[model samples]
Target: MDLKNKILQTPTGKKLLSEYQLNLLTKNNIETLLDFHDAENQKLNKLLAIKLESVLEIKKELDMLPWQSETFVETVNELDFGTGIEELDKFLDSIAQPFRRGRVWEVCGQTGVGKTQLMYTLALNFVWKHKLQVLFIDTKQDFSTKRIQDMLLERKVDQETSEKAMADIHVVEVLTSEELIEVLKAFDQQMTDDVQAALKTKVVVVDSLAACFVDHRGREMRRTRDSLLTEVACRVRKLAVRGVAFVIGNISFSQDSGTF
Candidate 1:
């Protein structure tokens, strides 16, 4: 009901200012100023005219708001998404592992740097340890039965564990980012609506977030693609806010290593 809550409802970047910013606009009608700046493509004058009288009624110059605490630390500490892989217990302890629920996670890295391996490991934790349901959105069409078999084999766990892992894990293949987005939007709502759903979803891993978002959008600055990625970021933030764990993958290459 308050400004802070409303601001939190919007994406972070979109919330560019505290009350301090209110001082810079032409008038003191804060609502009019916000509507103007946040307007996607609307005309400023027409938008402002409605509040012109309200602005004129204001007498005092807007005082800058008190400096608020940086939410980064709070958000990160609260960002409980990835599962705690027991085998990687030492590694898990080293990282700031946040207890997660169902969310979109974008795990990124350079190629051959353990993106896929980490995801499989995390998936195992979700099912075997946490007793959570994980819907793996496989866009690459690269999931191999052998890989799953091998992971369980290397761990030397029994067939019961392997079968249960495979049975509990749900996989869906999407051809593109647009398709992935649509499916995610649909699946999330469906999962929420299902009654007494045996599913206890803790995370959503996109294995490699880059593959689904390969199309370049602009020639001038090559920033177009990242612009599109903002939508995904919004979803990630929303999910995290709702306590879902998300593990997204990335493959970055470095010439020094000669591969990624």
Candidate 2:
């Protein structure tokens, strides 16, 4: 493949660079990976420089792989996963940008409105259909293997498939916002590791993000809460870039005025 085609083949390159930026590279005579690597230290505009840095980071990761390793581009799926609901999937597909990997989805609703249930369904659907893994971060200590098993049985899934699906849905309990951040950071590292098990994790479902910050009530802890949330967002985005889809569950607090 030529330089342009090679760059476009990688997820990071296709995501980070725009048509104009690619043209700019052509104008600058940076035609190959070797050429770009040599120009790494050259002065560039701020926006392009920042985008190039991320692409370069992905290149570095690919370089670290063994010569016999599979192509880096094949490590992640380029297609979108459905919500396991026919109507909902159709509706999302009608949108200009339908839900897909490398994106964060928020499922927010009032308590007892089936937010967590929806998260469970998504995780189950992803694992069962794709034979991929899901990282279910349970913040409220409500993750139940039995619940998932029951769901599988309800669907008339065979015993062997049910067992395999359950095994693929890895659950981790996190109590506080700090703990959530640490877990996300750990998952981020796992994504870059050369482990096949880590690569199988395509979706991360965080059940009830609000539960982690339930104690951050009053003015004193507002800043702390916001900081933690920002950190969590950053970590989530990092993982999403590596082709992991994130489904974050949140509770909507109702007040006298309306639900917020």
Candidate 3:
């Protein structure tokens, strides 16, 4: 008998297997009834393995509950990491909605108008004040450790604290929009897994998001760029919902009328 006939012979298979599954089995080259049986067994085995792994993970978390309660003291308020500038902070606060966690803030301006400088300042402030980690995604390769260090010292932050703050500002350089998407996806996975690094990372700074797509000029390239940007935004929003703040720097350009 054919695979369909054999499958329909069993009440369970007839009820369980959908037309799509039958097509998928044929696509996978499961021609014989024996092949179909083996494929079904493999799928069952994989499902069982996944359930077993989930149970093990739950057990591990239960075992660590006591230790976690003692070690992981949630001291800092995740929503309150502010810009270091007092005037700016005051203005933001006066609006009744300061830059809080679980949100994406864009700093947009013309080139050489201190957009990157502002991003660096925000990253520094986040690390220095909150004692939390900042993920600096530098697309233009403009990240300067010396600049960060000088800013810290100018603030009269001591040697130990300065070094620690800089250490917490993790900088990752990616040249292309595709690369940025990959980094964001990986960071999203890290956050989803509740890894130690992700737990500590309260802010993610993308310095100059425009630089990643500057070379994408043609229509096809522009479409690809837009798709990548959409994906990046989705991933960043997902991370924000997990209580991480995002500060993205973007460049503004003037049209024929000369207004940005």
Candidate 4:
């Protein structure tokens, strides 16, 4: 038999009409199905209502997704990360220039070159001065609350104020490439339009983006790594477009693999 007749003859199709209460008729076919939904025929209308109700319920679930109705802001809040040291602050200012939305900033340096320190200072500035929340992706597991508190104290801020500033910052530790990817995906899910705007969140700092690549090597390593990084960079750019700034930190050990 033909497909339509086969379905009509099947036990499942019978159950759809009897058990599921779907309105199926011999006259109802593909072209007429559209008319069923569009027209006011009682039986066809009932079937359309049943299907549309399920569709509306599915839409309700989709509305709860994290990245819903996010507005893409053209400009972002600019804050200065000025440590007392003139030289360091100048460097910070240079890198963070045009500190607006939709920008993925990569900070590269060698060991002990103050990459983490700079990121911590930026996070502190965002939380304390700009009144913004920061999602700090601590891939290196070296994010120190004590360090933040100490910096706040040095600025003559009281203990309660310092604690409150630290509270605005959320940290996640991801050691492996898989863990990093999973954490980023989870973070994307949890971050909603309302949450981002209400908390004034704009910064996503990934400390040492290269640390996740420790075990990522093989003949296909280059291709896989490139694909992975491209995916991450695309996500970061999208987040940036929605008024979030992504600061990705990386390290280098060789002359050939120096900072670009």
Candidate 5:
């Protein structure tokens, strides 16, 4: 089976891949699966192993992976948010300079603000202008399909490129902080040296980090949230240094943080 679509086609398979397959494919180590004489022709199986061996050899040399991997979908590096889209380009520019290698961004703002919209804009910019990939980690479950469709429609994102970008934008949802941690770790394992060197992580948006603190107990929630951001910032930056730019969103606790 083609590894790219295999996990998605099977419920159990995706879970297994998320749970265990990550470590097996990391940079320093790789695990191989061999089939026992089932194709009715021993030579065919031998040929299969040889083909796989060749794949492994090339993959090892590159020290990265194709965009089909769990990590590759939206790991876009050179964010050319065009001077179009009204004056929003100015805003995006002032916020950060396409997140340098080893850098990640956290977009924090008030409720009903354009924070999420900004993410969508950046997504479009990365895909259309630079043709880089992306990985969108949605914590709020608010990554709306309708909104994405609307954005594409509004910006005239073409059918083919839109389809391709939609397919490449890897999305993972998590309800708890711990699960988010696991997801990022698994996502990080897919990065290769070549991909990282290109500043290719388009952006990783958490979409409201403050909401994660609301249901918890005490003021300590801030600490927990802070710690989580620290870890997330750390991992994404490592990939950023290799050419991945990251963007995470949060809600502000003070007027000093500003609404815009």
Candidate 6:
């Protein structure tokens, strides 16, 4: 494939460059963009690489991804995963109108901001009110059953309902990224007939996805982290397409980078 065409085939190059930027590179001839893309000249590759990087970064910053375009139906059938905070739930509804199913949600904040608490609330609501199954994946295996039970009691939910609600949630603890990847890969097949029959699983929660990477640092580790995240994103997208909601938890130490 020609350079421009090849770039277009990849997610990084799937967006159209601004006409002004293209004009700068091609002198108003769109074909010149292709020429620059396919050029064998050493100097041209260096120049093209710089320009391409800039354009790709621009695309990413703008969220103008090829897969993100509104070329297909944009309406989403949603399910309410209420955080149990009335005002917060209202705010979330205004933002996404019930947090559409099959999409991934990331909850993050500093240590005391109730990120895990909100997750617990969401899981309980999904189970008790919605009568749906929730798969809770914990990296630290510290998810509190007692807390959920307390919340249930506070809400005046009967003991039978509380027991059933707790029963509907499945828990898995993984200490490594490899184990997390393996579980995600086999997720579809693991949704057995019995699992499918009791309650159609509506949510999967990963409490603190960042926990798996807490031990790693440096460039190579960062690359591995990014790759694993990409794989997770792909798998999550597939699950979402099949109508499962994914809720992810992340931790942040600074105000600028923490909350989602």
Compared with the true structure, all predictions reach lDDT values of 0.53, 0.73, 0.69, 0.60, 0.52, 0.63
Against the true structure, what is every candidate's RMSD? 9.4, 9.9, 13.5, 14.9, 15.4, 9.0
Per-residue lDDT for 1-260 in model 6, tens only?
33344345545445544334344444424243223422323343244444533443432332323333122222345555565568877997788646557667888776778889888878887777677788888998798989988887898978888889888888889987767877775675454323453227778989888887665555656545554554465556646655678889987666565322
Q: Write the per-residue lDDT of candidate 4 for residues 138-249, one digit (tens) a residue.
A: 9878788889878888999877888788888988888877677666555554565355533366678899888887666555565455545544654564455456778789
Q: Which pairs clash (backbone N, Cα, C closer than 3 Å) in model 3?
A: none
Q: How many clashes (backbone N, Cα, C below 3 Å) per candidate?
A: 20, 0, 0, 1, 25, 1
lDDT of 2: 0.73
Report residue 252 deviation for candidate 4 (angstroms). Answer: 2.2
Model 4 spans > 4 angstroms off: 1-96, 196-199, 218-220, 256-260
| Rank order (by TM-score, best first) | 2, 3, 6, 1, 4, 5
Name the runs in model 1 displaced over 4 angstroms: 2-88, 91-99, 102-106, 156-160, 195-199, 217-224, 255-260
User: What digit string (tens of lDDT, one per residue) describes model 2 on residues 10-102?
Assistant: 677678767787777778887655455435322333425544346445454433333221233334446788878788788988884555777
Model 5: runs farther than 4 Å from truth? 1-102, 192-201, 215-217, 220-227, 254-260
Q: Which one is best on lDDT?
A: 2
What count of clashes does model 3 give?
Answer: 0
Instruction: Output the TM-score of candidate 2.
Output: 0.69
Cand. 4 TM to true fold: 0.61
- Tens digits of per-residue lDDT for model 5, 1-260: 34424333444334333433433343223322111111112232243333333333322222222223233333434535442454665676787553343345778776778888887777666666656666777778778877777777887868986787676566777777667767666655655434451234445556655555455535555444444544444455445544455677777656575322
lDDT of 6 at 63: 30
Q: Which 10-residue window of candidate 5 scores lowest in summed lDDT?
A: 32-41
Report the lDDT of model 4 for residue 235. Answer: 55
Global Cα lDDT for candidate 4: 0.60
Q: Give the TM-score of candidate 1.
A: 0.62
Worst 10 residues of 4 by lDDT: 32-41
